[model samples]
Target: MIKNFSKLALAAGVSAAIALPASALAEIRIGIAGPQTGPVAQYGDMQFSGARMAIERINAEGGVNGEMLEAVEVDDVCDPKQAVTVANRLVNEGVSFVVGHLCSSSTQPASDIYEDEGILMITPASTSPEITARGYELVFRTIGLDSMQGPVAANHLISLEPKRVAVIHDKQQYGEGIATSVRDTLEEADVNVVMFEGITAGDKDFSSLVTKLKQADVDYVYYGGYHPELGLILRQARQADLDATFMGPEGVGNKDINTIAGDAAEGLLVTLPPSFDEKEVNQALVKAFEEKGEDPSGPFVLTSYTAVQLIAEGIEQAGSTDPFEVAEALREGSFETPIGMVSYDEKGDMESFEFVVYEWHADGSKTAVN
Candidate 1:
């Protein structure tokens, strides 16, 4: 009787041990929200692609703490109202970490929801300084702020020695904020800005604006807006036989501009972060993207990938999935990623990110200006 009892006890212990790891292997969901179906869908698509690839690689390598990382994508369409809804949905779905809401307009509103719910968000593209200036401990961004890039744009235009300059913005938060920064910097540098104006974002006709620029005899036009409007302005400016050099922020760096403006995009200038496509460490990632029939050279691609890597590394460092603990861990350490070493300041902005000028060519390619 004693021997039979011992055998049964040992068998029960073995059964319990066998079930432990299986229960611990449950997947953890990470949210990736952006404009998956709108004017800037290409940016969202790149964010999704980077997150998907990161999750796949991390899972294949045993994941975070032996549990798989799964991405739950939500399309906010870069709209503020839609972003709030997406944030609520992510909270309801029990996502503890999020990467996105690419535009500052959407990110600003969505961040409030995440903070109240204790969800940690890291944006890869939104550059407005206000995004971090809100003092939310749960908010962070992988890109530099407009305050940094604005001066760069101003200085570049000043170096061009244009007799007069014209500055235009779409009047949205991100567009207007960067535009205002550039205008202020130019004025401080004593550069003559002949015209500073605002235009509706979705307007298809910029002939009137081009006519104004022509009348001002502006040799350089600095546009603080997205690719669609910039593309149209470039085309119309060319059609009107204007020889002014067009410059814009990273918002205008998308390849879609090439399609929109055709050969007129050849001499367009843009300010953007250093190119990640030429990095030796990113060759594999670039090849992987090509194999999947996607371009890996967009402005936000590597930054999005770095955001995912930072979250996973934070989880590993914290030894828990609790959002508060992970946030603390991220603040305490630096991460090495495809974009190089990334460290955040107290405000959750990258410490070493820099913006450079690039000139677009007719073959749908951009080269950095020395």
Candidate 2:
């Protein structure tokens, strides 16, 4: 009887051990939000690819302080309203850090949610200056703001000395904001603003606008919007036989612009982040991205990789997974990333960055303007 009892006790102990929760094996979840299924999906793809490369490399190197990193993607559809929903989901799921919501409109709303939930958000591409100026401690960005790029593009236009410059937008937060900035900067520089107007995005036809521009005799057209709207305008303008140089902000930097506009997208002048992949500063990250079959053409790719690196560094500095601690570390910390050295001011904007002018060739390739 005693021998039978001893065996039963041992059997019960083994069963309990087997059923114990293996919580330690769960990965540290980081939220990655962006437009996964929308007109701006390409931006999300670039961001996700950059993040995946960084996460894979970091995990291979043993991850953040031995804790494996896992990214949870939340598609906000690039809409501001959806961004809030995604933000809540991430917070409820206990994700302490986030990277995303590529559009300024989306990023702005999502940032409010993150701030309220105490989650740290580092945007790799959202350039609306208003995002960081809100004084949200939980929000940060690794790229230059529209305030910077607007002047850079305006200066590039000044160099060209176009007889008449026309500024227009798609009426979205990003488009209108950038248009306002560019217009104001050019006006301050005494550059003639021949025509300024806002068009609705996704309009299939812009013939009326193009006809008006042709009548205005605009020499150079500065557009403030993404490629879809800009592409259509350019294509329609060419179809109408209007000859004017089309210039835009970094919003027009995707290859899809040319795909949509076809031959009309030729000679598109825009301002974007200096080509980091070509610089020695991004050698390591560039090699890793190439190994994973990811193209590094989009400037935000390096910035996204750097965002993850910054988060890891912040975690290490804070010595905790607590969101507040990590955010504190990020605010006061400076870390070298793929793009360059990254540090945040009290407003959570990058302390170092400069814009560059680029020209899109007829073949959908970009070249930095000298």
Candidate 3:
């Protein structure tokens, strides 16, 4: 549930007052920030579910450093402005580590605050390269960057040997950024890009865009945006009898797209993190999520869980709750997580990450393209 920032502040102050004594400081607070209410709240659900489960399992085994974990969740609404507000709220509430601000647009700005305030943050879903390019020791991600994912998508498209392609974006940081990456990569491969266009994020009617695609006679159309707009575009393009195949990055890989596009979603290709839930090692954890009626297959779920596990392990390895020390530990250590064995470079970007292309189904299932 979303909470007013003012009310969160008041509660934080009261909780701080009652928990001031050293004896009462038996909780390690983890700030879970994301869109608790917004267009992308479904993605936020995966993030929250993963982090919360990690905390529960970790505390069940034995509290970290003999202190239980406490979750302090804040809704940024995926708005960059609101992200700043929630970041301050986290600092005020004394969160040592954070797992969130899912959208790259929000994550980038919120990270600035986290760095300045000494709060360690690991985003499970943000893919823009700029978030880690700033050399902020406190900022890290459990997912790959647009640079990695864009080329993967581009290469797959190249293998198709389409005569012409159209790349489209929603004009947002996460959307346009990845779209640009894909366009650049496709150009480098000497693929003919027929058109590169942008659409408003919340636009419902895409008839004009469909006409353009149909006029371009593009063999494949790549979209860089979230599911909502792309879903409408997919449905509209098909309605206009545009035969070009549609492809997108993880943002548009959501199942809700199926509701919007119906059978049109079936042929859409998506570049997403590998299905970690399918890994043999993660089956038990997958079962755990299923037991709770949570779908663990969304790309961000295990990544978020890994982010929380990394934070806890980093603290234990550093033998301190200090954010800086924990950040150092994260950088210096290699971890076996549900996503994979993860290690960070100097910028805290994962050393090696892969994005797989999957064919989405109308029923919300996906099969990785061989």
Candidate 4:
């Protein structure tokens, strides 16, 4: 079930005004920020579900310090400009911590606000290396960054021995960063990066780009972008008889890609985080999703769960509702989460796991290839 926190209000002194000044209203307030209403709503929905599930499970077992966890969600629309506003709003609302601003573009700017406000922030799905490389004390992520995933995909492509590879990007930070990394890695491997280019996001026609690839005789095309543009590229390439196998980053590894590309989506390959379904420990999580009528196998669910668990553990260690103490706790140690053991480096970057290779089936289900 979907829940929104737009209407929640925090009372500054309500905790102090309680009967026992020592123990306040007993509500641990956390922020949930994401693209709750936009082209990337699915990502936000998956993230929100994981957070909700974690909170429900924790509450059922008795919340931390005898306080119930209350998450207030703010929609950032996955836009960088809007992200700053959302971050300020979350801070203004007196949330103890935050989990969101999903897109890398959004995460980058929103993180500054979090640091300025001394609020703890964690992103479950934004994988761009730049997001964490800033060395902010308050920012953290549950997933590995593009610095790892980009090269993994590049190495995979190089192993396939494609004669000529073409690279394209949506010109966004997340997309372009991954594409540049892949292009550099492929070049390092002495692979022919025949065409490296950037295309506008939300482009309707990729015929010109496809024609250029066909003329270059490219056997493989690597796209560092989200699913919608990838779908259009694949469909247009097939229609133009470009005949190149499409590859993309995890951002493009969604069932929605299949819906957009249909038959053209078949045989598409992508590099993403390791399969969550393959982990036996996540059976309960899968069951929880089913009980809530959500698909546990979705892209961001496991990571989202990990994010919430990370925050909850931090809260527990801090033994208080103060965001500063929780941030200190998170940076000082690791949390054993559903994704695995997650710990932060000095820069608040996670030294966690590697990305996985997957082939998107015609039906949109992914099969692990690596």
Candidate 5:
């Protein structure tokens, strides 16, 4: 569990902007839980930036019900065990809601604790369907699930009509789960799936994997994992002179991939949340993020902002601070958020969410292709 004294230590290496407003009249405390130090902490930066911005803006607008909101942040380091520890820390601090547990593996365990403890949680990035499939009233997210993302990628692949496709994963919950989804969808669509394999998450060398890909004579590769591994795979594959188009889910859609893979990152296809910052209606909000030196274009930023907005609105519509009432209000109402109109199904997932496919470039920018 992260203690008060270690907050600075956690922030030292992370690039996320932190804005914590302290009010004497703090009534509702929202716990921000995610990685402050980990391999995937770059994504955590988006989560923290969006939630902190929302908290700041909401408090500036006189808060909810005349009670100012407070923030209690915890670092889980994107590790499931650390997530459980931080979730318990949030529980002990008596936070009414949480905005994180970013990685799906971490979110699952932390959500189990939150559900039992009656803490309302809205993960802005964790997309494993299992998190919400258990029918937990408290678990919700601002992002679409692997079930939604996989088929989108596969359908796009089908349209391209590749001769042979290879699917790879990191063997973790999020990676393997989405990889399986893509494989299943491809098989159903009568596409030739040459291989489906798992790779170690942190492995640096992919020479052997490159050989396997070449041996399979695959023309396209679909990776289900975060950017780090995929970035390395792209770099090594480029060195080995393997010719194949690479596509991945949003998990591998970070700008850091450009840094890792260098020029090899160009032409990588990724399915991600729509560019909310690019929407005209959100220009002012995008400027607000820019003014504060935050990058709003990252996939999780606006979704996380919407998570905080939903919680605040849910509380107001319910006319109570009880998390149960807030949860019910969230499921029953439609919200106009930066992402778009959000209305939850009975399982607490958005009834309609859009995932756009983008063509990534080596300059750390992407253009929508589908």
Candidate 6:
């Protein structure tokens, strides 16, 4: 009877242990939100892939404060309304930190939710100046603002000394803002901007715009938009035999443009964040990504990786996952990341960031301009 009782007790103990919820393990959950399924899903793919790689590396080496890190991802489709829904879901999931909402349109709306909930959001790719300028204590970005990129693009075009410059935008907040900045900067430089226009983002036909460019005898065209429209315009321009130089902001730097514009994507000039893949320090990471059948050279990959590193480092420094504590720690210290050492200003903007110009090659690759 005594042996049977002991056996029964042991069985009960094992049963209780098996029945315990997995949540009892204790994990630090971080959210990664972006357009997982949309026109810009490529950007989200890069962001999430880099984020997952960081989380895996950190957890493998022993997580922050002994709590394992877990990633929670949501698809916002890069739409403003969907972004709000995604933000609320992350809040409900008890995620104190977020690194996402890649598009400016989505990030702007989602930021409001994060600010009100006291959740810290650090975007890797949203570049609208208004994001940092909005006076939100919990908002930050790893990438430089379009305000800095616009002038660089303008100067590049001016250096070419085109006969007549034409500027176009996709009519979105990011597209329009950068386009206006480039236009204004060019005009201030006493350059002739013969044509300024806006087009819908999803429009497939740019034949009319190509006609306008030809009619204006434009030698250089600066477009402030994503790669899709820019690619189409370049293809159509080549079909029309326009023979004009095309330049764009960072939004047009994606490799997808190679497929969209084919050989016409060659000779395309773009202003983008400094390519981190070229750095010797990132070679191991690049290899790790390639081993996983992923490309680490995407525009947002390094920045997104840096975003995750920032959050993990901040959590370690603060010794807590509390969003407020992490935010304070992030602002108080500089972090060395895959991109380089980064320090933030009070406004949550990087103290110093660089944008470089690159020329696209025919083989779907880009080389940084000296």
Candidate with the greatest TM-score versus the true structure: 3
Clashing pairs in 1: none
Q: How many backbone clashes does candidate 4 have?
A: 0
Instruction: Tell me the deviation in Å of residue 171 in model 1.
Output: 0.5
Q: What is the per-residue lDDT of model 4 for residues 1-370, given as tens digits with 9 covering 90 to 100?
A: 1233322323434543664544435777788999898787878888898888888888888888778887898899888999999888888887868887689999999988888888888898898888877778888888788889988999999899989999999999999999999999999999999989999987888898888889999999999989889998898888888888999988888888888899999999989888785699888878888988987777687888778788888888988667788888988887777888887778888876778889998898878884
lDDT tens digits, residue span 1-48, model 3: 356887899999988887786644778999999998899998999999
Per-prediction TM-score, please? 0.93, 0.93, 0.94, 0.92, 0.93, 0.93
Report the lDDT tens digits of candidate 6 across residue range 1-370.
Answer: 9999999999999888877545545788889999899888888899999999999988988988788889999999988999999999999988889998799989999999999999999999998999889789999899988888999999888888877999999999899989999999999998999989999999999998899899999899999989999999999999999979999988888888998999999999999888798799999999989999998888799899899889999989998888889899999999888888899999999988889999998788888887
Task: Tell how far residue 90 is off in model 6, in angstroms.
Answer: 0.8
Candidate 2, superposed: residue stretches over 4 Å from native: 1-26
Candidate 1 Cα misplacement greater than 4 A, ranges: 1-25
Q: What do the candidate models score in CA lDDT, each in turn?
A: 0.91, 0.87, 0.94, 0.85, 0.93, 0.91
Worst 10 residues of 4 by lDDT: 1-10
Minimum summed lDDT over a 10-residue window in model 1 is located at 19-28
- Which residue pairs of candidate 4 clash? none
- Report the candidate with higher TM-score, 1 versus 3: 3
Candidate 1 TM-score, true structure as reference: 0.93
What is the TM-score (0 to 1) of candidate 4? 0.92
Model 3 alpha-carbon miss at residue 338, Å: 0.7
lDDT of 5 at 15: 29
Q: Top model by lDDT, which number?
A: 3
Clash totals for all models, in order?
0, 0, 0, 0, 0, 0
Candidate with better lDDT, 1 vs 5: 5
